[model samples]
Target: MPTDATAASTEEAATRVVAFFETLAPADVAALGRLYAVDARFKDPFNEVQGVPAIERIFGHMFEALDQPRFVVTGRVVQGPQCFLTWEFLFAFRNFDKGVTQTVRGASHLVFDDQGLVTLHRDYWDAAEELYEKLPLVGGLMRWLKKRANS
Candidate 1:
């Protein structure tokens, strides 16, 4: 049952999510706190940060390290009540600075509020498989360790 509000909110949130990632490489506070709830809780491979301040810390590490790491949404799917944003991350970190570029594919699970602010956001992917394994000196070692441990 898609109500008018749900349809509009989802659409709006989707755009905002995209814009957030696109502009997020620079940590644009010019348009921050508007897309997420005041008590928003975010989690990724790194840390479980809550609220805007924690969000700032987690993202700060990224923007500072990633040589302009940006996310590009490949496709978006609106389920009965949720929107999953599939994205590809492009960046150049000393870890993966092979004198070229590196990209990692991932997805975000988002549940929006009536006002389109993200109430719950969860990211799904493997840091080791998608990122850590792509790093520099640590890349080979991490991959080998992961494989040995898994096997």
Candidate 2:
């Protein structure tokens, strides 16, 4: 059971994280230290890394590869020192369909430290359905594979 103070802290931490992600930009990557612990761990379908520097590199690559990439937090649940956030990642491929925005629905599980800094961040999303299937040459193949798998 969590006390009122613990619940409030959790909610506050989650709120800050949501705000950070929703307004994230290339310049904001430098400030990740304020939200994540020095040795925080971050993992997604395509990346598994620890430490703030490694996490920063991942976000840096995201900005370099996409145009207008942003996260819209749709829902959140906080319990004690952990929180879960559902979001949609919106962006346009810099080299591909630059005129159209693509959305990737995903969720992130975050565990906060005593100081409200994120200690563990794990993202859940289907890359094939949300990302690869939206690409150019790979999109067709991925769609075909999905059809075959479902048949």
Candidate 3:
């Protein structure tokens, strides 16, 4: 059972994390130390890493690879020292669809330490439906595969 203070701490941590992601920029990658523990773990469909430095590198790569990549947190649920957040990632592909913006819907599960620093951050999203399906040649192949599978 969580006490009032525990709940409050979790809420505060969740709020800070959501704000950090929504306004994240290339410069903000260095500031991850403020919100994440020294040995925090982060995992998504394509990458999995531990420690602040590794996480920083992942986010740094994101900035280098995409154009105007940003997250819009749509909803949040905080419980004890954990939070679940639903979000949409918006970005323009530097190499693919030039000026067109793409949106990927996903969710993240965050676990915070007693001090309100994130200890674990795991993202959930379908690579085929949300990402690969948005590509040019790959998109057509994936759609055909989906249709074939259903039929």
TM-score of each: 0.84, 0.97, 0.98
Model 3, 42-145: lDDT tens digits are 99999999999999999999999999999999999988888999999999999978989999999999999999999999999999999989999999999999
Better of 1 and 3 by lDDT: 3
- What's the lDDT for candidate 2? 0.95
lDDT of 2 by residue, 1-151 (tens): 8778887998999999999999998999999999999999999999999999999999999999889999999999999899999999999988877769999999999999889999999999999999999988899999999999999
Compare the candidates by TM-score and give the number of the best one. Answer: 3
Q: Ranking under lDDT, best-scoring first?
A: 3, 2, 1
At residue 17, give the lDDT of candidate 2.
93
Q: Pick the winner on lDDT between candidates 1 and 2.
A: 2
RMSD of each: 2.5, 0.8, 0.7
Candidate scoring better on TM-score of 1 and 3: 3
lDDT (Cα, tens digit) per residue for candidate 1, span 1-151: 8787787778878887888887674547434578788788788776777786667667677767777678889989875447898989888765445446778888888887777887677887788888778777778999899889999
TM-score of 1: 0.84
What lDDT score is found at residue 145 in candidate 3? 99
Candidate 1 has an lDDT of 0.77
**What's model 1's lDDT at 33?**
79
